[model samples]
Target: MTAAATAATVAPVRSSAGGNAASLPAMRVAGLEFRNPVVLASGTAGFGMELEDVVDLDAVGGICTKAVSIAPRTGNPALRVSEFAGGMINAIGLANPGLEAVKRDYLPWLPAHHPGTRVFVNVVGNSVDDFATVVEAIDGMPGIDGFELNVSCPNVKAGGLEFGADLQALAALVSAARTRTTRPVFVKLSPTLGTGVTDAARVAVDAGATGLTLVNTMPGLVIDTQARRPKISFGSGGISGPAVLPIGLLATWRVSRALPGVPLIGLGGVSTGDDAIQYLMAGASLVGVGTAALRDPRAPERIARQMRRWAEREGVNDLTTLIGTLQWPS
Candidate 1:
């Protein structure tokens, strides 16, 4: 990646005159600057506005908002999310107040996207037309820093084929979303095998995706050991949490190396500063926290603080220095 490209994504602040400049430095992801490497994954962090009630928002890298549709979506049925042994299974089908609601309810409250951490909006759709409508709706929504295109939604009726499974479909959808947005577009993909995340990532880049969010959850089910039935009403839901971190790391590393210039926002099961560091070394420019925060709303901030300590302990003053530091097997 070009130095200029790298510089484009980092959020510029006064450079914390008091903090340990001797620790982690600033980093960027696909032209969107981040104060640090720890960001709250979409669907996990509410509009980057709600958390201020618990902690200062200025501390973390960024906030990726919940997935939004062109219009308001009532969302899936009751019993949407269920806890599991090592992770979670969620069937909350893109529930949000929708695009306009975001502007009306969330945008006007924010200060700005300045050194004030990035805010990436997660978008979803059933078709290319669905994507275009969302793109157009959020065109100039205030406080929105960027868009995270959710193309990984499993097609339940299509025998569970992920939108990212077919190269042509993936490229076409990414291109459609890319052409409609002026803000940075971060394409989110599923981890299902043959989804060809790396190949789809190339298409995303070629079609103008600013970066990639590696990965949405994998489709799975919790079977009832006693009843001999599927636990969920839908029979399955997306899996997330610790059980998936290793796969997340592998996916982040593969895509980071494959898509030379594009930035990567690593997410899956990030729960600690060292985990964030590990993702960076594996090629993620920024790391996102999800399921952990589900159990603890303050998880994002906690990780941010932990990252500060981790940076100091490692003797690496700048977080960006750790990007792609790992040597993968040839």
Candidate 2:
């Protein structure tokens, strides 16, 4: 992107005066400026318009719209979601209104409604070409600041976890999408892949990803003893919530250390400002709120406030200073 185009996408930075710099948690990631660090995770905030009535869209820094596939997805069977002791398990199966519907119904509604809030469309596909095709089709659309490749979705059978797990496949998928648009492309990775997480991150970046969104939902299963069956209709689902917080934090920290300057959107079990602070400290430029927002639409706004308060108390003029500040004992 040219300087003029990049400038257009960014919200202006607040001047620091009288120790007020810490008041604005604004940041620039992958050549795009965000008003704050709190963003609504993908799938949770569908196309922004879905939660417009309940949540204040402008309150959060950005919104990652639901996954959009090449063709509409019917999704999985009944009982797509279930509750568990650790957190929530879901087998949403990447259900969406398809590409054309999004281009017609969703994309235009964003800038007209929530102009200031940055919008990153989540793109999913059944193949590498599918991923590139979606990005190419919507690359220049209005109200879109970037793309989040949903290669890490555990619920989908094809073009999901496999794209993220196989190093060669991941490289090819990212490379294809990279050729489609100049807009930022963030690869969302699976959390279940232990050490491969960093390896995958490296492969993605090398293949032309602008940045990375660490730790998608971990694949898991929940059983009902009395019913002797799975809790969700899909038999198994992606586990999210507080149970995955530590896992996300570790992934963010590890990838951040390995890739040093790469931008990461940290999310898993984030529900509070303090939790977001932990992510920033661990190396995330932004923190995504998913499971918590399902319970409360106002969670993102509340969390952003809490983060500013923490920054004020810590005398941090810029939240970016808190990024990757974790002190590992030698």
Candidate 3:
């Protein structure tokens, strides 16, 4: 299918509540309406159903499942996650049950249980065709609200940051994936792109991305002095937590400024309602909670509750007004 044709067919599925209200914290992004602005970042939430016993799934704005590839992956070796002073590093290697298993096991269960919660699948692959294949597999699957493309994943074919670092490659990947599904496509970017984040945002949007997810985990390493070895199984892993809050904020600000009116989902180091507000002010329509959930499975719901309290306390009737309201020193 052509990009234009796919775009034309894709429409935002309205919430049961319908349009946003001034007194509510609801938001609409790229046709998907969220009850709140706090989303569970992919990889941390484990396909959106794993936390049912501990978390109130319907409480958060949405849930992004871990990266789903065309084939099942075992991920990295042991010690997939390790903590630092301010944050944590992980090299889970996108371990997932593959698309077929997801469709059979998870999709049906979601709608029957958490009907109100929005579910976005995080799609990852080693090549542009790989991404397209995965998206095609889940195109019309029930209970899936949208997709967050993990373009920040290293492209084995092109090498060197793969699809994310190269504008042409990123556009091609997005365009290919766009043809596969009419669902909203959110491109998850890398902070390592620096000023390139703006360029990437433009390319992704122009290539048919419905929205952008600013600032995936930055790469980092933890060392063990006594063992003279890296802490995690992988020599280097993505860093996430409080340490990346400023990085995520700056990326959101830059991308929002560069691409006005485009929906953005900001993540990295968002553990509190205040942190979420910072992201909103910086230009993120929605904020994602990841590492904090690792520490406490109920963190996303807690953060959302706190955000609501904060909004009420400040007398901000509408949370949407907070977007891009940052005041800078002239």
Candidate 4:
């Protein structure tokens, strides 16, 4: 959709100087309501506890854990990530404490979390059953508010788009895990697959996804032009940074239009309040910051501040009213 259409669909922001974003009406995703619309991206925020002091944890929308596997993973070799033109490439290979350890270590620490803060655990699996196991295991864990299925990782052997490669596979993964718990499921998608996001998003919902997070990092690679070798040890990695903001906006807008009732969480290269506003205007009900948060854990608050200023400038009243307002220019 054109930017002009996006503008037309959203309600103009009605300004109130010195407004407190926290005082705005709450936003909900899959039955989980947040004080605001900011979420700490999965990988960038770790298990959601590391930045408690820097951020008023209880005030933010939610937190998602770094991607976790069914079993412990050592991750990629050293030099697994490298900076590029407008983003960074990473092949971290979903490094995490795995399910068992998460239950033993991460779970215990979660209950002590501030009650107002919502936590979502991200689960990844190589096969249908693997995902079910992880989801079932994490269900009802002391403090987890929801589960986000990570479908953007690469499959070592499949010459496909990983969990997102095929709709049948994605549906199966969702179907298997949906039966295991009552916690809401948010399917994390990828931008690499391009327009396929629409189909994948719908399929996930039909299979039982309560919400959608668009997107996972776009796959990328950095080469040492002088040395004639790849910059990352894993060769190719996921790309994320400001460069992805536009694409992320488009993806979020499209999905929101296609699935008007399901909640959509936007992520990709968001570094400023304007970026968050752009996502809002494009139809994202909630926005997640990854790379920027990695650089500065307090970035979410900074973005929230920026959002208040921008909303006032734009004449927008309730930000949630801006969702799916995007349209094609006449």
Give the number of the best model, judged by lDDT: 2
In candidate 2, position 43 carries an lDDT of 88
- Candidate 4: worst-modelled 10 consecutive residues by lDDT: 1-10
Clashes in model 2: which pairs? Answer: none
Give per-residue CA lDDT, model 1, range 136-164, as digits (tens). 77777665678888887644445656667
lDDT of 1: 0.74
**TM-scores across all candidates?**
0.88, 0.92, 0.92, 0.89
Error of 3 at 52 (Å): 0.6
Indicate whether candidate 1 or candidate 3 has the larger TM-score. 3
> Which pairs clash in model 3?
12-31
lDDT of 4 by residue, 122-207 (tens): 98878778889999888967678888899865444466558887887888788888888777788999897788899998888888
lDDT of 3 by residue, 1-330 (tens): 433233322122333543432113567766767878888999999976788898777778788898899899999999888999989999999999888998899766777788777888899998999999988888788878889999877788775566888898999999999889888888999999899889888888889998889889999999988999999988899999999999999999999898767788999999998999999899888899999999998788778778877888999877878889999879
Ranking by TM-score: 3, 2, 4, 1
Instruction: Give one digit per residue, the lDDT tens place, for model 2 in 154-240.
Output: 324343447887788888888999889888888999987787899999888888887889889998999989999999999999999
To one decimal, what is the Cα RMSD in angstroms of model 3 from the true structure?
3.5
Off by over 4 Å in 3: 1-24
Off by over 4 Å in 2: 1-12, 15-23, 153-161
Q: In angstroms, how far off is 264's CA in candidate 1?
A: 0.1
